[model samples]
Target chain A: MTEKDLIDACKRKNRQAQRLLYDRFSPVMMGVCRRYIKDPMEAEDVLVEGFFKVLTKIGMYNGDGSFEGWIRRIIINEALMHLRKNNQFKYAEEINPNLDYTEEPTVLDEIAAEEILNLLDEMPPGYRAVFNLYVVEGYKHREIADELGISINTSKSQLILAKQRMEELVKKRLGRHEI
Target chain B: MKTEKNISTLFQKGAERISVQPSGQAWQRLESRLEKEERRGRVVVMRWVASAAAMLVLVAAIWLWSASMQQHNFAILDAAPPQNLEDLENVDGCEPYCLVLKARAELPAYYANPVEKRN
Candidate 1:
């Protein structure tokens, strides 16, 4: 059945429909979960909780943007929740916004997803979380600020610094002349 | 199929994604939760009903109490009360009244006040 068809059936609370919906979305949502967190088990746990929240709040999905976007948001929140539960969010002192990261766009495209995740793993929990959330999910600075309990300026400066740090590491890993 | 394929690759790189196996366990748990929720719904309704009943009883009791108090007050007003004869005769001599003598009773007392008594 088409996704819309499945969603319609799920809205009616059909058991088969609910199960089918979960099967289709869980894997990708799980991937999204893993990005901000390290442990597979905890990521899976968040995925389950996120999926449950989505199921309960599905009626709130107004079909304005994307259904995937809606679910992606729930998974991101779940990851943040897990981070908070484990006391893993590290809030760095605010960096000066003037720090230059002009060439990050080209540098970012060159790095593999795996290497990025590795650098993310090494990041202080707070910085890594803000970085992944802003860069990967395309969340706005205001959004990161609101979610992470930091200011918009803080989010921007952090993203800039995270990119600068990630670039340095990627250059170190790939050697300077390769790119 | 590029979009679908991209999604598949992204998922594959992360780990083996759990193919959603429809375990009866999931349904069973859902059913139990829903049942519990249903029970909670009933309990909420029952609570509202109980509150409404309590409010109604309180209103009724207050109404009866006020009505009884009004009736008692009316009874006091409807029956007679003692008034000073001097004042009573001086103003309006409308009702028969009696008072115990404060001192020795004088045989007969009569007066015609020329000035209006300031009430």
Candidate 2:
């Protein structure tokens, strides 16, 4: 079925259509969840909850935007909610003064996609959330601040720290791989 | 040396390529939750229907009783003086003295011989 047809069927609560939608989106949504939640099981839980919402709230979709984008927003919000529920944002707001800001930027061209995800997984939850929102998800600092309930400056600073931390992690992984 | 733009582009590209297959059980859990929600929704609707039905029955019973009371009041008002205890039983709001008067009028011999009857 066409995407439109699939959505209409889902809106009608068609079980087959719902399952198809889940099968199609769960992997990508799981990837999105993992960027914010490091634990595979927790990420899976968020993925399931997110899909449940998508299916149940399908009627609210007014066809104003791409369905996939709408679903992505829901999944991202769910991940943020999970983090907030766990009090992960407390560490995200703390400014680490001792971070090496002057470290040379390492070439990330040679890194595999899996390695990049692993690097993201290793960062602090707060930094990872900010980084995922700002860089990967293309969210503005203001939007990230609102979603994370932090100041704009905090979002900006966390992005910077997250990048620095990513560089360090990439360098360490590269060094280990080269040896 | 990578600029901020280059770093973001790299990570964004990686994120685009990243897709992990969720465990098979994830769909099962979601399906069960959806079913439960559906069942709950049905239950809520049924509860509302039952409550409405009960309210309707109570209203109908009240209306019928009031209608019968009105009819009985009209009969009592139009009828002649009470000829028997059964007739007096339908006389609503009668004072005790009024009931005594009704009893004496309806059954004179019974009241007249009350003292001898007591003996």
Among these predicted structures, which one has the highest lDDT?
2
The digit string of per-residue lDDT tens for model 2 on A1-179 reads: 99999999999999999999998888888889988899999999999999999999999998998899999999999999999999987544546544555645455455566887798889989989988998888999999989988877788778888888887787677662321
TM-score of chain B of 1: 0.52
lDDT of 1 by residue, A1-179 (tens): 98788778877667688777777787677667766777766767677677777776777877788898888888788899889889986666778877764643322213455654565566667767776776567678888989987789888888776666655665566554322
lDDT of 1 at A141: 89
Question: What is the number of backbone collisions in each predicted candidate, taken in the order shown?
Answer: 1, 0
How much TM-score does chain B earn in each model? 0.52, 0.59
DockQ of 1: 0.04
Worst 10 residues of 1 chain A by lDDT: A103-112
**Candidate 2, residues B40-111: lDDT per residue as tens digits?**
999999999999999999999999999999999899679786555565565567567477776667677766
lDDT of 2: 0.84
